[model samples]
Target: MSKKSKSFFSHFTIAHKITMMYGGIFSLSLLIISFFVLVNVTVIEQNNIKAEMKKTVENIDDYIKNGGELSQETLEALLENKYIEVNVVDVKNHKVYKNSVGKLPSFVRQIQSQPPHGFLDEERNNRSEELEKKGFKVDIAKEFNMDDKAYFISSRDGKEFVLLEKEINFEESCYLVQAFKMLQKNDYYFRSFGLRLFLIDILGIFLSFLIGRYISRKMLKPVEEIQQTAERISIEDLSQRIDTSGPDDEMKELAETFNSMISRLENSFQKQNQFISDASHELRTPISVIQGYANLINRWGKSDPTVLEESIQSILAETEHMSQLIKKLLFLAKSDQNRIPVQKEQFCLNELVKEVVKEMEITTETKRNIIIKEQKTVEIYADSSMIKQLLWIHCENALKYTKQNDSITFHIYEQCEYGCVDVQDNGAGMNEEDVTRIFDRFYRADKSRNKEIPGTGLGLSIAKWIAESNDGKISVESELEKGTIFHNAFPLKKKKNQKYS
Candidate 1:
């Protein structure tokens, strides 16, 4: 087959393919059945013809033995039953009786008049000897043809006419020669039967095709509906959902799965749009502040040292803030895309926590009492730098929220096979709602506090990302005005056994 033909066949609809398959199978099965039936009928008819011919020959033999001549009644009975034509031939190869063509030649009486035991006993012996010498294997009964007429010769009791009786004694031996000719005449029976069977097969094939088409259509109806629903839905219009109402079959499951996928896509698209909008708003503020300060420096701020120094510092601060915000946003984008390269190693959680506390105390101008409590050597498998960053974010948040002289305690220990670090501060804590969304990007607990503190709200979000990338979890516990505690937990690394350290 050519590729074009193959492609054409492949393009056939499911219903067409099913219809063709069903039609082919049904037509083949019907043809096989019809063939067997016709063959069996032919065999049965042939057997019956052979059996009736033998019976008629036997009956004629018995009548002649009782000194009764061949009667018209026997001839009429055989003719009425449509049996084979019969011919009785003597040992001299002379026909004694022929039913269809009337009496035939019989020269036995003239050849030997009262010479031997009966009419043709001597001739019978001579014929048998000749047949055996010629490898004929002469039997008591045999079938032969002469002049297009069939005869059954039977030899019996070594009598004159016993050769005729022996051959025709069994019902299976004798049959009408014209019976084969007559059977040929009824060839129309086969033709008619074949025509009827062909018609039936054609009808059956047509019905099978119809049924297959109907079933395919019914089965694929749900799939077509799903296709239509999907075609109507686009990225801009993801609100369209397939509403399936049926038993929990495969079709119903497919529809439900499709709906679930659409719902996820819609949520992701919404989040992406929101993130872009939030990023624009956050970046716009720093740019506007820098622009305003640049304007101030240009407008007579260059003449005054104080104005020049203040505008320059303010512009630098705002630029730095914008740079930090952009870096955080880029990091989050890489994290979301699963492109963050994490190199994990074994590190002590307690040591990292102590270092972060010391660094915070040195860097900040505030006199807050930072204390390390419950510090222990708890080893964990994670990216050490990312874990340190996570700890610093939490410590910075504590310092930012707390006033000078406020106490912030750091705890590092192992609990339940997990290395845990906790940063607790006596700072302005959050309500239940703020605690819930504390890790959300660009989410500030109090807008007024944000102005006073002058800090980007992306710290906790970045901190959460760092902890999760290191296979750790971050959680917060806080009450309004009672300060807040941020806990980070990681699975403790198992120690490998060694023969020598």
Candidate 2:
């Protein structure tokens, strides 16, 4: 049969859904964690740079504290390790001194030239002209703060440079000292680091997706097998089962459950086919007999009264047998459908058994040596009517199988939590095979459906339903040519007003 279309999401198989969910959630989580980690790492790197700049500031301070003067040589000495520029101002003469020789890194702070008058008149014309030729002192620094200990200065491109300036008393004149830490290398490090991080994140997402898909497929393989097995199974075949040889996990449990369902389907199908075949065979006999008699009467009964009477009697008996068979079938049908109602009450088994035994003795045509050897007044909770019928099924079977002198005994007593009854018979008993099949529908110990047996072969089946429906247990013990014992047990303790329908 064609399947109906489902929603878009429903069209996805379980494996696909699992893969998508696992991969999507984990990938998103990885991205978020990577973002925070990147930010954290950047902050720590910047902080370390700031700390190194402070160390450079202290080095410059120590240089001034000693006898080192802020000249061209002083600035050159500080720039020996690179990434730092220096400046000095002879404020009393309105002249500044700075390092020279090569172009400064563009990422470092640039010395913006101010009005030339920031320098002395003689310094610009005489000292500035001579120093400009030698590239030692010039009026290019635009600002200064003698009180500023350490500070950061930013360029137009969002890059930072650390700077510090202080005043020194030298030759009875105040000299301004300044320092700048270049950060071009740090900028390069950040750009390269960010690129690597982005690439690694992408790779991680790809690998995670592949792993999720593989694991989902492996885990959901059993579910796929179950679906295939079900599709292959039809009314004609239910023997296919999922492989359950694996670790005891949820997947294993699901496989076991699927196999169990298949087994039950096979059993039910077998029972249904057997029931139809047996019912037809049982009915065909009586039907053929009735037809034969009717033919006998139809051709000759107008003049022969004997044949007419025989036909009518045989027809009525067959009809009655069919009716009895129908009633038993209906009982089983109702019981199987769980339509039979239960009304429970506490009752004494001894009194009920005594009454049943007495009734059987009085009504039965066959006289067995019947007696109740032990009758302990054990109270049990169950449906009394069903129990009565259950008792009668055993008693009637005993009467049917035994001779006039064989003994049939009834016993009732308490055993732990159960109230028990035993209907034991000394009769023409059966073998293990017959005993095993005695409770099956339309099953006779004789197996041949003997006419002399006088039974519809439904008594034991009805007896089993009665015992189970009334919340009791029933079992039979028999030996070939020895005897049979039918044991029934019911719970002595059931909640008041417990009902089963």
Candidate 3:
């Protein structure tokens, strides 16, 4: 046999625990049902045989009792083919008197110990003793109950008794008796039958397990496909999508969600790469100009104050711009890695907003007014340091983009869903297209705007990252030259003892 077939057979050869559990229950039930059937059949056949024999015995009794004329010649003449033997007894002589082909069984004569009205057994010794003691005659047949020997008894003249024994034999009687004995001998066959039932139950259980495993494997096909699709995705190949057409189950939903996440990740990665490439190219020209102008001053204007002042101021501005760009790039890199682990603590929202507004006033030359239209003493969980950085980006962006004397409003309070912070300005507002990609890295509204501001274009991107990391959102409403509204919304944190009104 093949190895698989041999292994399968080996499993059946050893007893299985489940097989024993279920098989034992089913086998016992089967044995009980079989036993009932066997017992019912045995009882019915025995009853029928006894009923027919009793009928025949009753007929002989009626004939002998009515006439008191029982002779072997008369009995022989009356019963031409009947299976019977008749005997006449002389009570006074203590001997048999009528024609009889067979002698009486000794067991039938030993009847002294029995109640006179009931049947009794008298074997040879007991019969001889009884005959010597009582001077009365008696006769009987050897067997009772079984069909082999049965008889009819009646009295003649109140003293002499007549015994007519029948030899009850038919072709079917022998077969019936043999069958009954076989049934009695092998009465424990049900145990073997229970064993066979156990084997069948074991086979059924094994089949069910095998079929269940096959169905499970077929059902998991979609999941296996999704795993393979995920494995194939890499930095270079982030565009692969899983087939989600099998069924609308959890696996299908997972595949769809995975595809959506991959699309977002691919777009984000592409934007990052474009920003790095553009930033590198844009910085080279200004750096080269600063270096060239410095070398010119060192060669020809060693002691000229005007030349020295001009070169120094120009070099300082270039250095500052470069420093700002480098800082923006580093911040973007940190956000990309999700390295900013937040430190949660309770803090006052109103106080923090005042601190930011006060700090922004010190560094700017523009007459940008800082107005706090709304203030509330709300406490919330946040990383104070990161939140301050996030506030700085928004405040600085509003200040930088607005023209001189543009009033900027900083609203710090609570809304229905979040702790609201709205930074609105009346300056160069963005168009629809620009607002969409404004929070993207190195994305500027116009090339002329970027040149005037000398920005790295990552201010809004870093601000947006901080907001999202803290489970908040940043949005804008703007129109060209009219104004821009930068809304910073943070989800409110529940206080220990304070309840919502």
Candidate 4:
């Protein structure tokens, strides 16, 4: 096709394309059927004409055999209004005995001049030849001529006719009888049939095009709605969803999927907003403390030794807190972006847990008793440093909440195909609601006492990420004012002949 044709078609919608496809296919099919019908009808009409011509020839032959005289009046009376013409000839005299017309067409004379192509019954012709050689005579010729057609379409009057010839033997004389019948009625019938079929095809194509357009639009309605709904949605307004009220089909599924996407986006945006608010609040407190310490140091640091020393210590503490907070924030940001790379290796959980317990014990040296309740030889594949950091976080958390004379117990065992670590503290435990959200970043239990807690709330959140990055799980159980138990389980993926005490 040309570029112009392609451009033209590209402008058409899917509905229009469907309509045109249906209309073109149906119209082509109709034309093919009509063509076959025309051929069949023409053949049937030809057969009918042949049968009628046979009967008329037989009638004239019978009349001659019955000794009835032939006349123009008799011929007209017999074949009136039938569009039939007859002619009788005397073969011996070479003269016209009877004719429907006073003068014959020049074409008719040309046809009569040639002998008929009767070649029927070779033995009869042989017999006639034998008699002629024995001084007897016979007039045997073909019943049809060489130039005859099944249908003779005459150009003189643009009419269709069938021509037939027969030889009659009457009282030892031969007579030639010719019959002609025009097919004007059959022609008229075909013309009328073609017109009706064309009209019907036009109506059928129009209806098909209309029906195709309607169905295409109906099917694509949901897609249009999806586009419209999407156009109205933005990061600021992700709550808008496409309505999915229809049959359980692909369109409905698409709409449902679109709505689900929007819902996820909305949830993520909400979390992002909350994170920003909480981060701002947490950073603002340390900033205010540092600013106050700087103002105090600037006013009295050079003049008074005690005031200068106090301000330096206070400033150092605030700076350390802010540094820890910022580090935790950066760690979480990298984890969220999947930029934290973990180096995994086989490590002894029992040995690692014992080391963390000993280190934390030496660092605190508190009145609280940190006890190792149980130990097991369980090997797992994970980043040893990450696991150590995780254990440290949990131990530090346990130390923070537990008071003097309270016991912080540690346990290591294999449970359900996992190497497990459990840290139980007899400290200020939280309620069930706090336990549920304990791992959320920046979430601290007992907001009333949060100011007294001397640590950032990102420890447990970081611990959770470390465990999950190593394909492990963490869970916590706490009861208000009773205690909290933190559990870590890693899949026992490797085993070897190694021991640790």
Candidate 5:
């Protein structure tokens, strides 16, 4: 057989095997039963014939035993029963004692005309002869073919023998022969029964296969959805989620895992991109300053000592900027590795904001002029150092983007259960687009123009982490000329137990 056909048969399913077994058993049982019934019907017909023959023998035997010759009354009764003929002969006198004759059928006449011999015994003798050739003397009389019909013989007075002969139609043999012939007449009848069963079995198997395939597809539908979901995902489209609508099965769990992996991957990618952008921007600034100062020194140092000294100062300044940028980069890398230890505690947010503003005034360019607009005390539960870092980023960002002499404002207050802080800048305000992406690491609104500023894009990203790490959120609102407002909210701090020291 071809490979495909071989494979199909080899992989035949449980249902196919079941159907074949059922049909095979049913067909086999039917064949066996039909054979037994045919044999039984033939035997019954043979017994009926034998019984009639025996009844005739009894009538003839009674008449002879009564010390009377074959009487006219007995002979008349035998003749009246149609399809029968009888003759009794006296062997000593060689004369016919009694004869009752009727117009017998040809077949019956043929049976009687045959030489007087035991019909069943003679057939058994023939069968014994056949068996003897095969080296076995089988008890042939008990055989089904031999016992189906019978004949008998008797002697009168042991010497003056009277031979009485009677025969019946071979009804069983004739009926069986006719039946066998009829069964052979139409090949389609017998063959079609089995053929139709086979066809039905095949159809049942095919339908079951279709149902199994459909169920398999339904069971695996979630896997298919996961595949399509995975296919749809790219770095830009990682935010997409699986469309789950069924019971929470393993497939749903798989979909959930897939979505989680995408989310994590997207976050990592964003952080990496942010790191690269910040590093490039931060490194470029100092390099540019160093180059400009070096060029200036080369051109004018020898001509003027004051110019040479000023160049040295400028170089020192650029070197300091580079060092600070490197330190921030290192800090960010450590944080990415989760190496930054958190010291959690209940701390005053108002005090933290005040400290941040004081530091900014001391260190930044648009410094002491910035006003603190906070009116109320705010406190929260968080890591103190991390929250301070968050405050520094917001303040520094506000200071950097604002023009010289523009005032910065800080407002601290309570909103519902949250401690809210707002830092407003009155300098170069941002647009909606800038507000949306300002927190991305290393992202600057004026990419080309901000090259002079030694700012790493990671500042706001770090600030965002600090806020979220403590179950808080940061937001921004801005208009092009009206300036920008950076908002931060922290959960309320729980009361700490006072320890007696």
Candidate 6:
């Protein structure tokens, strides 16, 4: 087939394809049934005709046995009652007796003169040779016989007859031949039945095609709706969703899955737009500050030592802040893209927590008291640097929120086969709503805290990412105006062949 033909077939709608398939199946089924029915009916009628002819032959044989002479009246009465004709032929091929109702055809009369004992075999061989001479092939293995009688079917002037012959012991050597006309009424009935069946088959195929089309349309309605919904959806408006209110079938499941996909795409688009806006806003302020300080130094800072020093320090601080923000953003982007590589090793949770607390105490400017409440040697499998960064972020947040005289405590312990660390602070705590969203990127609970404390809001988000990447969990418990506790938990590593001293 050509490509154009294939393309044309492919372009057919589902309903059209289903209709064609159903029509073909229905038509084939009808054809097989009709063919079998016709063949079976014809076989039954032929058997009935042959059986009746056999009975007539038997009756004639009994008459000759009883020494009753077959007269014209007897033959006429037999014809009226049984629709049979009889003929008697002698060995010399002479007609001894025949019914007055009808005369035997010439072909049947000629066959009747043959002897009865091996008559069937002889006739079959002779017919085969005759057909072969006329350039027609014949299967000599195929022979026709009924009981002990030799029979042949013949058609004369468009009328069909079954001729059967049986030998009887008469005073003279004679054979009884019976002829039964193939019933014209049966032919008429078959023709009428065939016409009706053809009409019914045609009607059935039409109805089945229509029903198939309807079912296909109903099945594909959901797909059509999905296509329309997709056509209306755009990047700017991804809020369009498929309706899934129906029975729990494949179509309903498909619609639900499509709706879920649309929801994910919408969330991704919103986040992308929000990230771009936030990044621009954060960078704009730092760039403006750096430019302002540069202008100040250019104008008068060279001659004035105090102005020069202040401007230089301010520019460096702003530049450093921008650099740190960019680095955090890049780290978050890598983490989001699942590109952050982690190198995990066995580390002591107790010593790591103590080290972080000591370092915070030395570096923090506030006069807050920081201490380790509980410590135990607990080994964990995790990325050590990421764990240290998580602890530092928690301690830094504690210091930023607490007052000068407030106390912050670090606790290290083992719980439920997990190495655990808790950073508790007596600081200005947050409410339930703030605690829920505290780890969202760039979300500050106290907006003024971003200004009062020189820090970025991405610290907690990055801390949460680090903890999760190391197969750890970070949870927070805080009450309004009360202290807050941040818990970091990692699965403990079991040591084999080595015991902790």
Residue 462 in model 4: lDDT: 98
TM-scores vs. true structure, each candidate:
0.68, 0.71, 0.54, 0.68, 0.47, 0.67
Instruction: Answer with 2 or 5, whichever has the higher lDDT.
Output: 2
- How do the residues 422-493 of candidate 1 rate in per-residue lDDT, one tens digit apiece? 899989999999999989989989888778786778889989888877668889999878899999998686
On lDDT, who's better, 5 or 6? 6
Error of 1 at 141 (Å): 16
lDDT of 2: 0.74
Model 2 TM-score? 0.71
lDDT of 6 by residue, 1-501 (tens): 899988988999877887788777877887799878876877777677766666667777777677776665655554423556666554434455666356655544444354566454465436535534544333322133444444343343455555565656577545545454544445778898888888888898788788878888888889898999999999978989888887889999999999999999899889878877887788898899989989999999999999999998999999998998898888888887789887778898888888887788788776988778665678988888889988988988998888998989888888886799899998999989999999988888877656867776788999999988777899999986788999999868633543431
List candidate 6 stretches off by more than 4 Å. 1-17, 43-186, 342-346, 365-368, 373-375, 403-405, 493-501
TM-score of decoy 3: 0.54
> RMSD to the native, candidate 6?
8.5
Worst 10 residues of 4 by lDDT: 142-151
Predicted candidate 4 versus true structure: per-residue lDDT over 31-97, tens digit per residue: 7987788768777776676666666677777787998776666655555335456666655445564
Poorest lDDT segment (10 consecutive residues) of candidate 5:
174-183
Q: Which portions of model 5 show Cα errors greater than 4 Å?
A: 1-249, 259-263, 270-274, 281-285, 288-307, 364-370, 403-405, 447-454, 494-501
After best superposition, candidate 3 residue 348: deviation in angstroms?
3.1
Off by over 4 Å in 2: 1-20, 37-42, 51-149, 154-159, 163-180, 184-215, 447-451, 479-482, 495-501
Clashing pairs in 2: none
The lDDT per prediction is 0.70, 0.74, 0.63, 0.75, 0.62, 0.75
TM-score for candidate 4, residues paired by index: 0.68
Clashes per prediction? 9, 0, 2, 1, 1, 0
